[model samples]
Target: MGPDTRARATSESPAGREQGQEYDASPYLPRRGGLAALRRASADCRGCPLFQDATQTVFGTGSPTARLFLVGEQPGDQEDRQGEPFVGPAGRLLRRALAEAGLGDEEVYVTNAVKHFKFTTAPRGKRRIHKAPSLREMSACRPWLAAELRLVSPRLVVVLGGTAGKALLGNSFRVGEERGILRPMPSLEEGEGEGGGLLLATVHPSAVLRADDREAAFRGLVADLSVAASALD
Candidate 1:
């Protein structure tokens, strides 16, 4: 691949991950609205072929009245079977940490950039292991994510990782550089859902779960989340 096609890399805690390179979820459909109907309507999503392998499309969870919305990259192994976002091991870590960060899972609406489970089938002695999604994959799933954003219209949106960051902020988003930075939720404002919505970026709890020093990475994750917690203060 050309250098221009290279994955943007970062120096985080995830040991086995191709550090510095945040994978893209999709590229084809960029629309960020009309999900409630589209999800109800389409039996098949031509936007991306990811739906073919996934069990079912996992949509966002929480109340329309929630003040905060947290977005992650995509679903993981356990989440795939559950048909909900953030139900996997990583999600459990997030749930605990987010609570310490000053919010409960119920207080924040949670979702993924892509609603489906995307992984490479591995021959684990007759089983499969999980892998990350590609940029094109993330892009294809963007439309559904956009749809969730419109429906929830959270007052604060926390991007849990790069995929969530790129989907809303653009390709050059760097969590290390921009963590704790909250920007106006332009789309929410434009749609009249909520005013003063803030968008912040942070390391996904999953990233910390994969870290060499899990405790340290989690602490950092919590510190960033503390900023999120303080958004209400």
Candidate 2:
């Protein structure tokens, strides 16, 4: 079925939010479709106000059947303009770390907890500064992530930051406390069937970029990812 038709099939009511209600993306999700259908439907999503300022919805990319799924916090300025996740400086670092951890490109799928970029503008120039998405925004955008997890059913998921970890695991997830260990995946919702996969949390590559000890941080990220890679063996 087509994306629009599939989206309509999933929801009986029109897509909108009532006053005083939190924004939700579930109505925009397709009842039955693959990644392509989900991607197309997401383009028209008004699930949250973040869409207003973003250039476009940055959806996950990589083989649908990839065994290793990588989740980041959200798209950055470069990802916002390009409409692709992990193409910026941090992405470069992540690519290197993945290689160091022995994870090939072909085995990995990458996405973010939130599809839109939330930012603040600088006073001097038109430079946009990254702002972390509020927990409400993360909650609003979660249906997409849940759908992806349900479809992919990956053997392993490498969470690249606390935000992605919290979005997938729970608000109580702490990367520092939980990094470098494989654990069972949590269901995004009741009866979602998202369990059974292995999950590993780690510092986002952006953290390595901003770190005082860059070499150490990058090594730590690679080490955490290495644990994920070994689990797929």
Q: Give per-model CA RMSD.
A: 10.0, 4.8
Per-residue CA lDDT of model 1 for 72-129, tens digit only, reads 9888878878777888788889888888887764477788887777787765663446
In model 2, which runs have C-alpha deviations exceeding 4 angstroms? 1-17, 191-194
Give the Cα lDDT of each candidate.
Answer: 0.69, 0.87
Top lDDT: which candidate number?
A: 2
The 10-residue segment with the lowest total lDDT in model 2 = 9-18
What does the lDDT read for residue 58 in candidate 2?
98
| Candidate 2 lDDT over residue span 66-114, tens digit each | 8999999999999999999999999999999999988855477899999
Rate residue 88 of model 1 by lDDT: 76
> Which pairs clash in the backbone of model 2?
none
